[model samples]
Target: MRINVLQHTPNEGPGTIKRWAQQNHHDLYIYHPYQFGVLPTAEETDFLVVLGGPMSPNDSFAWIMKERQLIQTLMEQGKPIFGTCYGAQQIAKTLGYAVTKAPYKEVGWAPVYLQSTVIPGVPPQLMALHWHEEMFEIPREAERLFSSDLVKNQGFILNGNILGLQFHFEPEAEDIREIVINDAEYARHHNALQQSPEEILQMAIPPENRNVMFHLLDFITK
Candidate 1:
């Protein structure tokens, strides 16, 4: 399958997802739309994977709008799509949901209780990595799948073709360090839900989280 990756920033690439695609021998293409000001058409790839960034979907940037339009087109074509964090916010916005600031920023590792699992391979609960102050409402036609103690809408699935996750399941050890280091100032928020950069960097990534990620990839692509 030809999987197109839409990455928002240099620091926030596809991480382990890229490794999975490579190991699985699927053809993968990447677009840095924030830098290039261009995105791939739905016809160009079999599936779309949108990665996270520090930007908000509500921002009136040309690239952001273009990405949303691309998402809309992909949805109309019934292509499979997966989004994480900022990417998920874009999907929510495309589906007529509002993306707003949460009462607190959520950073570091936390448990996301599974509300329902239509995707088949995920577990009942996941200790996932989250690093966003923004939250999105569940889209009208989507099945709300996960919720966290801090965020009521942690994930959703639109039909069986689209999945949106507010947490990070694709980050490896170095990706975690880069994410924390690049967005260190966000960790300065005094909210109880926010974690210090040092704390974020030192936390041990649970093995089960990676297992969930692998299951999600297979569930989405296969």
Candidate 2:
């Protein structure tokens, strides 16, 4: 399988998802939409994985609109999309939902409760990792699949083909540290930051989070 990844920034690269792709023998072709301004045709990939970034969904940057169009087009073509944080907000805003400042930013690892009462064959509690200030308003016709105590709309299912995640289930422990370190502005705004690597790691991701992502992958592929 070939996965086309839309990377929005230099620091924020696809993390755990890359592991999944490699483990499953899926080739990943990444396009930095900010630099290239053009994404290769999605017809060549088995899945579309949109990585997270620090930018706001409403940013007037050229790539913002471009990626939106790309995601919209891919969805119309029935392409399976798995989006994280900013990528998820892009999907929501593109699909007519609002992405605004979350009531309170969730900067560290926060466990997200599954909204699906009876997960086909999985547990209901998942340790969802997060690092963002903006949250999407759950879209109409979209089922809220996961929620955190702070953010009720943590992840949503669209057409059972597209999955949008507000948290960072794909974070590579280091990514969590880098994001908090670099985004002191975000940290100050929410006063929701961890001061040290130890503090951040304490919010340690749940072991099953990766398994949950795999389940999502299995669902999307099926």
Candidate 3:
């Protein structure tokens, strides 16, 4: 399968998703619209994975708007699509939902409570990395999958093929370090839900996190 990844930043690459693709013997291609202004066509992409970024989906950048249009097009064709953070917001916005500031700027490791068992093997409550100020509204027809203390709409699944996750389950230790270094300002924020850089880095990446990510990937593609 030709899996096309939409990467929005230099640091937020396809961490464990790449590992999953390698293990599953699927080809993975990453495109950076923010840097190159290029995206894969629906015909070239068998599956779509949109990575996280610091940018908001509400931004008026031409690339952002264009990416949303592509997401919409893929949805219309019943192609499998998965998105995280800003990518999730893009999916929601494309589906005519609003992407607005979350009640709190959730950063670092937080617990997300499962609202449904659409994706098997996920624990009832699991810790996931979060680094977004804006949140996507749960789409009209989508089933809400998870929620956190600070954010009500943490994840949603649409039509069994489209998944939107508001937190990071793919980032490894190095990926988290790079994210913290690139967005140091957000890491330093003192908040009830936010964690310090040291804390975020020190917390071990739970084995279940990657396992759950892999399960979701398989579930979406199946």
Best by lDDT: 3
- Flag regions of model 3 displaced more than 4 Å: none
TM-score of each model, in listed order: 0.95, 0.89, 0.97
| Candidate 1 residue lDDT tens string, 1-222 | 999999888778788888888889899999988888888887887999989988899999999998888899989988888999998999999988999998768887888988885877677887888888898899989989899997899999887879899989999899988888888887777645666889888888887777777777787667
Per residue, candidate 2 scores C-alpha lDDT tens digits across 1-222 of 789999887767787788888888889889888887877675775788888887888999987887788788888898899889998999999898899998777776667888874337657777766778789988887888898888788988888889998987776677666665675455444445443435665576567777877878778766
The TM-score measured for candidate 1 stands at: 0.95
| Residue 181 error, candidate 3, Å | 1.7
Q: Report residue 211 deviation for candidate 3 (angstroms).
A: 0.5
Each prediction's whole-model lDDT (CA): 0.86, 0.79, 0.92
lDDT of 3 by residue, 1-222 (tens): 999999999989999999999999999999999999999988898999999998999889999988988998899999999999998999999999999989888888999999998777789999999898889999989999999998999999999999999999999889988998888788777555657888888889888999999999999999
Off by over 4 Å in 1: none
What RMSD, rounded to one decimal, does every model reach?
1.3, 2.2, 1.0
- In model 1, which range of ten residues has the least summed lDDT? 186-195
Look at candidate 3 and give me any clashing residue pairs: none
